[model samples]
Target: MAAAQNTPGQHRGMDWCGFAGFRASKAPMQAYAAELGATMQLQVQMPRRQPAPADIVEEYTYTRHFVAIDDPVRLLEILPGLPADKNHTYEIILKDKPCKLCVDFDGTDGLPACFASKQDFTSRVQDVLTDIFLTEFGVQLPAESFVWVFTDYPVKFRAHLVEHHIMPDGRILCLPQHNPTHATRRRQALLQQAGAGHA
Candidate 1:
């Protein structure tokens, strides 16, 4: 059952709709690293306000190479699944030597899983991205670094910041604006497809 309702902004932990959040500074990641030793790096940039709000907010990119794993498809199937409201997009390149996976995620239909505002979320995500690249790929993120990764063919995560300007009327517009008709059709299609498949 969908549990009892609570605050609108408060997400239920088990619902699978929240964010991965700051994985470091906690156990598991910390615990795993204790045994793994210094394999990664994490860096951050101080926030700077623009004379006028700009579309470009945050960006990250990383690349690494791994021993030709026996099966790359299996490796990809295991990465955490993205929420329906959100979508993760990337390219998997397999060449003669090693294999590489490049992936990134945008804010999607809702606000980021962490931070109070989009700006805060952008900064935090950038920090996490740098940390992952440093630790996973053994690379360092430089300020104005532009790019945080450079490795053989393995796995890479990258992101960019795009924005929608707020009108002088004090209205902010974002993607995935609610459309009741669209929602209803999507739900009905799901039901019909389920029924047809079952038959």
Candidate 2:
């Protein structure tokens, strides 16, 4: 049997939004960090019941990603009392201009875990970052450069269509008709055709 697809509300009361599939130039990180000094920070929390083994500790440094922890202070208090052989989790915080973004490694590689209260999950941090780079640092990125995905479990993503498509005959087609309404119509037509074929 096929596994159930993950969607929002599957986990009951938890929804996450973040960006993926966007590649930014290395210049942004360098420029931001130069201006802000340590634009990113690594937060490590040692295990509670037992200390992390040497290999796990080494892995933390190598992977450069950490599990999300609620209270770092509480974890620190227990850290001093536990043995030195348990595993710890890690979290990376990126200090983007005007917003402190938390990077969650699960579901997608380095998805910024921005809650819906501030904005919908469809919002892309990459767009904001791209704007900052262009306005502040004079760096320009292509349109629709960031893809945002929001979900409750497993994981699914939605991205904008590229500006142009290349045909098999080597013809290049500009995609001005790539809006949501066109996509919905295309999907409905495909479904209707499939249903008729099945009949």
Candidate 3:
């Protein structure tokens, strides 16, 4: 079940940037990365967070490409030297090319899974935050655990997350919000349909 820890004075009413927290787990990284070496390729895969009971997915996420620990003895040595509290991790930018990432938010209701760029690397953070929210609370939250919602509507052509689809986990997944003009037009069309149906 997902759990949350709130930070003080961080809430901005119903729709602004809010901070919802959850219980973090011990890092299973060292054991996970042990199958690495110069000759033997480490087939890396990480578990994706499930927002609902039925949606269990896995993403092949890695920060760095290759950890050049060819010697068996060296692998045992430096692993212990890494710091703790590494629940949140990043992929290595390898010498061959930048590491490709595939991220899923909540794993239940997701924005499409695609390769991310260096500029948009931070966006995957939403995936991490959503994972914690869903896994701990047993609820699929909006792509929000630590997110900055706009104070006003149509912030950079994107509207608010007020009315949206509620997932099985009680999370709201709103359609991509755009400019006020388009949203207003869509709302007008919906209202017209409602009126026609009543008549």
Best by TM-score: 1
In angstroms, the error of model 2 at 163 is 15
What tens digits encode model 3's per-residue C-alpha lDDT throughout 1-199? 3332222231112111112211111122232335442432221112234342332111111111123345657545544543342222333323334222222112122221342432232344445435644686565656433333221111111112232236666745433333445545544443233231110
- Candidate 2 local lDDT, residue 85: 42
What digit string (tens of lDDT, one per residue) describes model 2 on residues 7-79?
2221112221111112222233344435545433222223234443554332222111111224556456544
Count backbone overlaps in model 3: 14
Query: Each prediction's TM-score against the native?
Result: 0.22, 0.19, 0.17
Question: Per-residue CA lDDT of candidate 1, range 100-126, in tens?
Answer: 212223223343333465445445545
Candidate 3 stretches with Cα past 4 Å from truth are 1-37, 40-66, 87-199
- C-alpha displacement of 56 in model 3, angstroms? 25
Q: What local lDDT does model 1 show for residue 157?
A: 21
How should the candidates be ordered by lDDT, best one leading?
A: 2, 1, 3
TM-score-superior candidate, 2 or 3: 2
